[model samples]
Target: MKKIREIESLLGLPSPSNISVWWNMGSLLGFILVLQLVTGFLLSFHYTADLYCTFNSIIHIMRDVPGGWFLRSMHANGASFFFLLMYIHIGRGIYYQSYMMQPRTWMVGVTIFLVSMGTAFLGYVLPWGQMSYWGATVITNLMSAIPYFGTNLVEWVWGGFSVGQPTLNRFYSLHFLLPFVLSVLVMLHLVFLHEKGSTNPLGSLHHVAKIPFHPYFTIKDIVGVVLLSFIMLGIVFFGPNLFTDPENFIEANPMMTPVHIQPEWYFLYAYAILRSIPSKLGGVLALVFAVTYLYFFPVTMRMNVLPMAYSPISQFFFWQFVVVFGLLTWLGACPVEDPYVNIAPYLTVMYFALPILMQVSNSIWYKLIIS
Candidate 1:
């Protein structure tokens, strides 16, 4: 009875009444995490980490295991959904200045984002398909951009001159291990979130009513999860390979190459940024800076109010930032040729400019509101 009551109290934690569907995204992400864990575990039973066996094992899973295809599809598509929710969760945090109000929570969340990407990269290499082999080759080779020790670093990572069985074994080990690390970090994130309390869209909500997590927000999260399930289920059942690359259908060939060597869609924006630069080392650093920029958000500018409350000009720029992001994502999907090659560098400049423009807007608004 005592333990049960403690659990109920945790679930009944208080929150602001003004939160919208955007707030439910975190809970939806939690649901996807659980799905990934379950499916990944089951898929492990039939998988082999050996380079020669990896592709054949995946094919066997699809053909021999009773429900293996479903499991594999769910795991793959679940990753897609996981990233989709994370982008929304992170974007909402930025828009509402949640990072400013709950700095520790934001920090943990961003760390989890980085870890999740590492985990996904490890998982992508496991299929050992054409794209998997070349993608692994391309990404691992990026380490050679380091000044003096770059060649040694690449050798250390490859466990040889090139990606092979040793590399596959290491990636498989890390892919299995990182998800558990992610779970622990997620617990820390929730701990900080609960300590600081949730951020409301209007900034501070001292004047608003507070309500319990159970019955109200729990019910809201359930609704969000159900709606999300419909879309995920449709893709899993009908079009399992919709997001997969056709090039991956062929077994990995060291001698042959695909016409295009693109990554999964979520990484496309960063990939675009990586390709925009003229110098290899500079491009690698730019990719690093793109994600690391989030770490500096709290220190860049101090704002007393949320982005929405900051000023009309800030809000206007915010929407422009969103459109620019979409444009970058679109450019990422297109071939790195002709007009796109010229256009990407310009968009890359604008992408970095958005944050500086944001801080400028915040400065003007602070002066106007205070004076």
Candidate 2:
């Protein structure tokens, strides 16, 4: 009875009444995380981590494992949905200055994002396809750009001098394990969010009416889930391979690298940043910094009122950052030569520059509003 009451109290906590559809993303992400866990657990029963068997095992799952294709498709597409919702969730946070208000929550959220990417990268290698093998090789090789310990670190991660059976086994194990870690981090994120409370579309709502989360916000989450489900089901049944790379269909052959090696869509922005730099070590550092820079937002955009809500200048810069992000994603997929190559370095500059610009603009606006 005590536990039940606690659960009720948690769910029934007062949330700002004016919060909008954007606020519902957190609940939707929770749903997708559970869905991915269930589907991945089921898919693991028939999977083999051996390099020679990994590719064929995936085929066997599709052909023989009774509804295995559905499971595989759901798991695969769920990952895409996971990243999509997460990206939107992160973007919503930035637009609302949620990070500035709830610094601890934002920090945990960014760590979750980084860990989720690592988990996804590991999962990407499990299919043992051409892209899978070479993608693993390319990304793992980035660690070798570190100072003296670089080569040893890469070899240790590979379990040998090259990506092979040990690499597959290691990736498979870590991929299976990381989601559970993600689940815990998510719970921690919620704890911090509930502690600090949610940031509404408005800057602050100290005097506003607070509503229970159960019926009001839960309904919005349900609507989001239903809409997301329709899109996911459509892709799973009608176009399972819609987001898959063509190179991944071929079995992994270390001897033959794809003409154009690219990661899944979500990593494209960072990948573009990685490619734009001429130095190997610099590219790796830039890629790490690209995401980690979010950590500095609490310091950069610190202010009492919501930083972005009333500031049109800040809003303009935010949208420009979004455009730069999208352009970089597109450029990440293009062939790494001319026109495209020339455009990426410029976009990379804008990608890092725009956030600082938003901070400056918001700081000025806050001063004017106070005056």
Candidate 3:
């Protein structure tokens, strides 16, 4: 068929040499996306979006539905692991300077990450558990810091003065819809990838050396997927609650807030940022700006111009930044008092400063070598 021939042609196009294990991350992310979609669809069949019934529905699914507990645990734990892999994937891109050459691909990937976060946040509220209710309340209320329109916007988002039935319904609908959008974005991401082709560790262009995607990379991807699935299955079967908040085990109660409110592990870094600042508006703006500013890294940061892997100093800073990010994630889960709160701002500063430091270090290193 013409279609098959065209597909063959696309697959036959060349890619960069020395791609290594880092290249497998994009495919790995794609694999996780598929798993999330399949499990989410199955869970949706048994889930109810109503605030009054949402908690009970989740309980019913866990207790009554055949293999429902497994499905829910897999879906839940999968989210944390998905974020873990994504952070690594993004970090790998930065380390290898993959974003510099294929800016569009990197940009699309960032968009996918943001959209995925939104989808996950919406899904987290569906259980209507203690953390779910208050987490939604705390996060949505952050919008109330937008000067004149803040309170009104917050009310509009909640569909009432507070988080209630309407909030749950809206979140459920959007959560169901977002995965479809993410799939489309992923297709676009691949289109951009194929257009520019992949950037390998050696930073070679596609024209210099390329290979067929199918059979070669396909087999590689399958191996990575299988390995990742095994790890995910172990967690789903054996330690489902390892990463979840125990407070969420209780049903949602608007009257009483948890002693220490926190979000799912993935949101911990941003949550830490939110709690670090004194001003509500400042915290809200900081969160939004933190992510949006990443889009400008390719433009504003001078180090992005460097041959990244060749620069030892830049590589060191890049990995250090990742370690700091992990630390922030852990700190976010801690109580927002004393040492945690006191330490958060310093960590947050380092978190934002890493890229700039890499840029500076890379620039100086380039000059020293040239001079």
Q: Judged by lDDT, which candidate is best?
A: 2
Q: Rate the local accuracy (lDDT) of all candidates.
A: 0.88, 0.91, 0.85
Error of 3 at 287 (Å): 1.2
Model 2 over residues 1-371: C-alpha lDDT tens digits? 99999899888978899888888788888999999999999999999988778899999999999999999999988899999889999999999888877889999999999999999999999999999999999999999999999999999999999999889888999999999999999999999988757777875636367888898888888989999899999999999999999999999998898999999999999999999999999999999999899999887766644347788998999999999999999999999999999999999999999988888888788788889
Model 3 Cα lDDT, one tens digit per residue, 1-371: 99999899777867665678878888888888888899999999999887678899999999999999999998898888888888888888778777777788888888998999999999888888899899999889888889899899999999999999988889999999999999999999999888768887876664776677777888888999999989988988888889888888899999998998888888888888877889888888878876666687677655334678778998888888888888888998898778888998888788888888888888888888888
Q: Give model 1 RMSD, 1 decimal.
A: 1.4
Which residue segments of model 3 deviate by more than 4 Å?
302-304
TM-score of every model versus the real structure: 0.97, 0.98, 0.96
Candidate 1 local lDDT, 1-371, one digit each (tens): 99999889778778888889899889998999989999999999999998788999999999999999999999999999999999999988878878788888988999999999999999999999999999999998999999999999999999999999889999998998899999999999999988857878876635357788889988888989999999999999999999998988899999998888988888888888888999999999998998888998878767554356647877777778777777887787889798998988888888888877876887788788878
Error of 1 at 43 (Å): 0.4
Task: Give the top-scoring candidate (TM-score).
Answer: 2
Order of the predicted models by TM-score, top scorer first:
2, 1, 3
> In terms of lDDT, which candidate is stronger, 1 or 3?
1
Residue 287 displacement in candidate 2 (angstroms) = 0.3
Q: Candidate 1 vs candidate 2: which has greater lDDT?
A: 2
